[model samples]
Target chain A: MQMSPGSRKTLLRQVPTVVWVLLGMILFFARFAPAFFTLKNAVNLLTQGSILMILCMGVIVVKITGGIELSVGAVMTLAGMVMAWALAYAKLPIPVALLLSLIVGGLCGLLNGFFVTKMDIPSFIATLGTQGIAAGISLGMNNGNVIWGLPASIGYLGNGTFLHLPVPMWLSVLAFLCSFTLLNFTPFGVYVYALGGNEQALVLTGKPAWWYKTLVYVYAGLMAGLAAIVITGRNMCAQPTVGLGMEFEAFSAVVLGGSFAAGRGTAIGTVIGVLFILILRNGLNVMGIPTYIQLAIIGPVLIGAIVLSVLVEGGAQK
Target chain B: MTLKSFLLRFSRLLALVLLSMVVAVLNPNFLKISNLINIVRQASPQIIISAGMTIVLLTGGIDLSIGSVVTLASIIAGYVLTQTKLHWSIAIVSALGSGLLCGLVSGILVAKVKLPSAIATYGMLWVGRGLAFAIMGAFPYFGFPNAFRYIGRGILLGIPVPIWIMVAVALVVYLFLKYTTLGKSIYAVGANPYAAKASGLRVDRILIYTYMLSGLLAALGGIILTARLNAVDQDIGAPFLLPAIASPVMGGTSMTGGRGGIGGTIIGTLIMTVLVNAMNLLRISSLWQQFAIGLVVVLAVWLDMWIKKKTA
Candidate 1:
């Protein structure tokens, strides 16, 4: 099992540059920001980052199929709004309300899939349309106001401790497992990669590529729905705009994870990617940097890291 | 134009007419001349922005940063106009110049660095928005000189200046796409990049120019928006991104590139403007506006696809 020096070098090169950037960031933040490395802060970061982690799990599924899932943020918002409405107005039990949110999210995903596969619209545009629809419905449902009066019991799902870990952390891990298993251990997973890498081959094999493509969007929608439950439970209310711009963050995390092109990404890679973003943002927060300034820095860092990976690792070349 | 091309071009017009009829029936006030002018004026900046989007779309790319570019360019202009002692005209130059620069960077990212359009432009969106936020920093800029305001507010030949600007922009873009070698190359490149490159057309250069044009036009739209509002803030341009994208696609411009034009975009803009106007006049909750627009975008694009299929 001894590897040659050249082969080892190539193996090392296959590692995305984000790993190093992530290490550097950790060291830099730990030295400069005294509060960055605390156990408490780590818990807080995981709690906050769980929603992003969940969303990224969904986004990577679609990205691997060469489709962008822009509607997840809005879909999550709509799902939360529905759940909140069911809780506050309909007086439904917590479980029913939660199930409703997932259904709503899946329905939105179905619409996106229909637009993309059946209507032949580009994924971004189709998803953008769904974003508008979902966002609009969320806003219109509550007249652009926050919905309050959720059952106290629901908050336990979002904020309560589970085996000394935050509930959100557990839920996010569960989501990661779902995405990981679905992407790695199933015939569907292979078809998903083939959909992006070589659709003609998939079609030639008598596989229904369009159906798998549609399922990718649907999977993303389900994740958004799950995120909605956590966010709603945590806040104890649903704000129509709570999920705003979340899709962009999820997309960035997936791309940052080394899914630079279709058919090239891993669940492990996405976890690192999520951690990279979570750490950067959390570190900046610990350092007391203004939100606006942090935004300016993150943009350059994101693009630079991706470019470095592409150039240095020669990863994901067409 | 052949009857087929004529129908292809004016199908959106028919939709616009039918939509106006519905709105006019529901609210007769919507049909008033003043209100109609108001709609177009309000839509002017959108039309300009969508024109830029249409050009980029024609070249088989998307520019998500146009909204951010709008915010940054106008803020730059506002900073120049209010904070500096420079002539008011300098504000215009600064706005357009900054916009062009943002587009150039995006172009290099997409055309040369070979990043995906969605990712490159999405990054630019953040940078532009962040820069705008940094520059403004918890305070908005206002109180531009009257000369600057005139572009948005003043009347020209019984019409608002914004309307005139919109028309002029449409005409110039229409002509450019029709006659200019570079403009034609944009279509060629979008239709098939490999073929375009093999045929000695500089696909990369065309992509850069298309993005640059989109940026410049977005800045121009921002200038008008700033003039009308008489102020500038970081959030001013955020909402325009969706409609800017929806309009050209609704106008029958293919999202996949190489088959739509400014002519279709203008009609699409009118349809959206009228829809919004109808909603406002009908006293529907403004919250539903986003939903309606989103529905229209999906339906419009769906309709476009259906028509394309039928024709093919």
Candidate 2:
């Protein structure tokens, strides 16, 4: 609460950079390819952005709690694979299958929470360990096989459109609203920020710091679980390799959205982060930029954003 | 002493020894001369890369670009061998030079431009990977020089040259870190950059040198990797990023910086090699191996923290 106005101004200015990058990407696509800016293209953007947005939101929460979880990608893979395994091999009801996947995902997070809290392990290492656990279980259950032949019900969640938006996109919006409400309007959110800003101080307050801290891990797990659902729906199968390295992408988006990894973040910022990254990728695809070049451009864009944040912060403080 | 701290120092080595025993027991041929030599050869590049990475991590900085930088070096060497037919020496130097440039760029960003090493090196990772892809356009270079093959395959005093070279390189690094003021400064910067700066140690220079060293060592890895494969491709260094950090961090280096050394890192690297050998022999399934590494990374880091807490 005692953060300087200068810092606030700096953070605000950094926020617009993401918007501009998104705007620039949209226009870049529109100018280069007419089809890139169409309603269909917008829908495509949303569908892709939904999964990433969810993952980033999860990451944002963890970061705000002053913890970084690198295992969300592996957790997503686990969730999706379990859901597919239930439906395909066990022939379970799709709803039951879906519930199982979410439960497994949350359990993965809870495992992460347990290790980090009870074991006195740092978040990064603890998650990395559990990430392997999730990946192992997901792969072992399927025996290195891709779980295909998804049921129609689950596929609908991935492919169906609701009022011109993909179902997953709708889910993303719902997730955003829910996450935002919890983060911005709840005491838990306050505690998370305070935890990130000053963990020792929070500890001194005799607040249930470990509970709130571990809750963020659970929060991440839940969001990743939701991401798994969307991703599974889209792929129509669970490939064991479904979510490797997606965690880094989420990290980049979170940073781009002006959510400091040192704590102080927002679901709103994470959503913007997801949107911006997808837009840039879509724009590159539409423009026929070689994949390599597109990937190359990402570096400069990311570095530029960071530099801008620092510079804007310096200027505002000055 | 706390139980955690006590274990941090011994668990990794114990794990290494246990893995070796398992591998050797499962396949009596595990520690055979040729296999042992092969393991050392395979590990040489990674050991060199870790040497550089240790310094960066010691300074409380992470470099995500080492893998991409290796790829870049591979392509550069590939381009040289394919395009010019340069003598082995020239080609090797150019490849290392290219990697050094990448390190310098990363260093400048982190040290001079004041960017977080994680974010900055991450930028370099994408850029470097992209550039590698752009250079080769999906084609890999083949028909490495016969001399190049010698660099990787040639034996010296009953051991592979890469192994000997790695030992020599590690000795130099170990000595430098243990005895040199520059090495001390690298640790100092990581331990407390503000304090180091206040003490009038050139923190920026020290960091820049550390990254430069990392780049060079990664290229050394690339050169050997290319020679071993006898081919260079854009994707040559893809699997290195995680393993590189996993071994060092797992060896009890604090991720928060300012602790650890070539000793633990080399042992850690050897341990990884041994574990991989075990899994391959056990046919534990690739899924389990990946999971195991991930799990071990967390365990090692946590073990280190717990031990530090217990002792302190």
Candidate 3:
């Protein structure tokens, strides 16, 4: 029974399936464990996954465009601060504040895209350079202060619920839907997959490749902006450091979703990945696992998944 | 030469100078000799780490294990210094040896096993951090000899000890990059793997040495940092990894591969280190400092585009 090639391949595939199984185990625990099954914990997991989902979507988009965006987390932090400032300090209306936040995000995203696409700079280096810039702007703008005191309406996104789901969770679902639609339903989406699959070939197609590449970044930026809204709402406050190390988490999620780091992505897979991480983290917290050990667990899971992806696709990759 | 290429290069050089000038003018204290020394000393570790990182980058690889290796090495060094009767010199070797071992593992995973560098290092990051945590508990190490502090704190007449070490490392890396066969092979490998393989270079061997060097430098940095504080913590190397890569990128390392230098990275590190310390000294709130770093990273990345557009 063990000698069959089909079973061997399935076994190899099942190696990576362990992470998905872990998700199932966590879901089971959430169902049976009194502490884990509480409404509060359920809502907690939802809100947590909300921000992670939003950030992960952007990462997926950037990855799909055949580039990495390491600065999404940094930009998210900056936008969060800006959104908070506009509502609290600038004393703007909610709509205006949202617009300003979106604009900031879009501009940052545009700059990053422009650098990588137009200037022929590598996306990783370019985004990293911008990560510092985003941090600096946040610091200079606020002098390292936290943003607070937003009107209750703007605060609704963080804690509000509809149909029993947390607001962030709803937003995450919306973002996921939008990404799926954009990637699958539109010609521009077609262009993106083609772009990632082969940049030079796409260029030879006589299209304005830069514009297509740039648009995904802007879209990613918009997603980050939305994430900031939910994140700020959840905390009812925003700080420059709010999103620190977030990009890596998002990147890890994207990778775990069975997406290639060299830039192939699927929205559905990424959503599963994001959910898997959210559940894993929340479940661990509920289990009284130490934070350090929790991080250690993530490491093994990431490696195992990646190794599984490589091994399963090794022959097919060529 | 093409006008676009020349102008692009010129603009990069000018951006480097102007950035320094802006910082200097904004704070006259930034221009002082003491501040200059401080900047170099601060950048020493990052500059060293970036040297090896640049090589890895050239080969289209990343090393997340840097943070972990540093943590492991510093702890090993710290434990030897505090708990054992072994001399400091031997302790240094033991510490650096551990870092090399981690780096070697990552390299083998990447080069031989053909695992992505990012994934391999990510695993090492955890394992290494876990080892550090297991050894040090939750508290910072404080029982080291003051003499060990000399590596971080001593000055040669007017210059800081760390600054001298930085200079020596920079010169050595530069020479290696410019003249050595292995170094040239690294560039060749990065520039075109197929071509290099056809030309009879062992790409894996080059990659292994490159990452090993990165690990060694990062470990050295952790030891210096721990010595400076007279304590080692698990958190030390973790935060520095991004900045390590960021400085080199800002200095114009082509993230794609085969385009950058130790000179540019050194300058970039100096600018960032000084800026960070100055912010701290000025007592800018932590939030603002984080915001500022984010903004600076974005702008530096954007600068390439702005310059290219201008040239176009």
Best prediction by DockQ? 1
Work out the TM-score per prediction.
0.97, 0.94, 0.87
Candidate 3 docking category? acceptable
Task: Please give, for residues A77-162, the per-residue lDDT of candidate 1 as tens digits.
Answer: 99999999999999998889999999998999889888899998888779998998999999988789999998899999899998
Tell how far residue A132 is off in model 1, in angstroms: 1.5
For each candidate, the DockQ is 0.63, 0.57, 0.43
Model 2 chain B: worst 10 consecutive residues (lDDT sum) = B1-10
Model-by-model lDDT, in order?
Answer: 0.90, 0.82, 0.77
Where does model 2 exceed 4 Å of error? A1-15, A315-318, B1-11, B309-312
DockQ (model 3, Cα): 0.43
lDDT of 2 at A225: 89
Which structure is stronger by lDDT: 1 or 2?
A: 1
Off by over 4 Å in 1: A1-8, B1-6
Docking class of 1: medium
Q: Cα deviation of A28 in candidate 1 (Å)?
A: 1.2
RMSD of each: 2.0, 3.0, 4.2
Superposition error at B300 for model 3 (Å):
5.7
Off by over 4 Å in 3: A1-43, A315-318, B1-32, B83-86, B274-312
lDDT string for model 2 (B1-312, tens) is 756555656777777788788778788888788888778788899988888888889999988899999999988888888888567788889989988899999999888777768778987887788778777885788988788888777888888888988999899998998899999998899899999999999998898899999999999988888887898877788678777877788776667789888888888888778777778767788767877767666766676666667667
Candidate of highest lDDT: 1
